[model samples]
Target: MGAWGISTFDNDDAADWLADLSDHQSLALVRETIAAALDADDYLEAPEASTALAACELIAAAIGRPSAAARKQETLTRWIAHRKPSPDTALIADALRAIDRVLGPESELRELWEETEDYAAWQADVVQLRSRLSH
Candidate 1:
């Protein structure tokens, strides 16, 4: 069993698989984990929350390298632009707030204001980046 009882792989296999991922896959998985954390709810257990943060941080660490892939770059770009819904889901809201706190109020936070009209184009660019990386 895994966090939130969402087991998909044996711990050993999962660890090996995670270790073996390409830079792009690793980065994508990290972003995805952060997204998952944002989606968790009030009844979340400490273990569940810890797992999400752990996974999220792992991914974030991978992308810390200058050579991290374009897909990872683009994912971070688009995810930043997406506004948290009013009555925003707690997990996502907390995750976003936490990231913003880490990265600071500028760029990730401020860019939201500058990128409004260009967000669609930016998102399209992200999809293209992902496609390129997957090839």
Candidate 2:
């Protein structure tokens, strides 16, 4: 959990995942990441959760609702310019559902954040991500 801030792409896992996404330029990776989180039957790991959130952020960007932080990332910006992903409604719904799972009690990422004084801030970031995905 190499996190500097609570924004979607602020962790090592997310950054690495984004790099992979940029390299592959595949929207299926984003969908798969979100599905991984949503399909988890046991406790979701922090890295998985982080990556899912990053996937959600990508979906938001595809729909012209990128967060300020996401818009600043060179790789993500470049990927968006090149791929031009147009996420369907199902992907958006799945991203939203994955976000819910990440925020839920069974999530290691959520549990880890609960121990910090910045839990509220982290939660707010997730809520903002969900909001962005909603539209």
The whole-model lDDT of each prediction reads 0.35, 0.89
**Alpha-carbon error at 6 in model 1, in Å?**
22
lDDT of 2 at 16: 92
Instruction: State the local distance difference test value for candidate 1.
Output: 0.35
Any runs in candidate 1 off by more than 4 Å, and if so which? 1-26, 63-135
Cα shift from native, residue 79, model 1 (Å): 22
Tell me the spans in candidate 2 whose CA falls farther than 4 Å from its real position. Answer: none
In terms of TM-score, the best-performing candidate is 2
Instruction: Give the clashing pairs for model 2.
Output: none
lDDT of 1 by residue, 17-120 (tens): 34433334224444455554445453333333333433433333323311233133333334323421122234334444434332233233224423566545
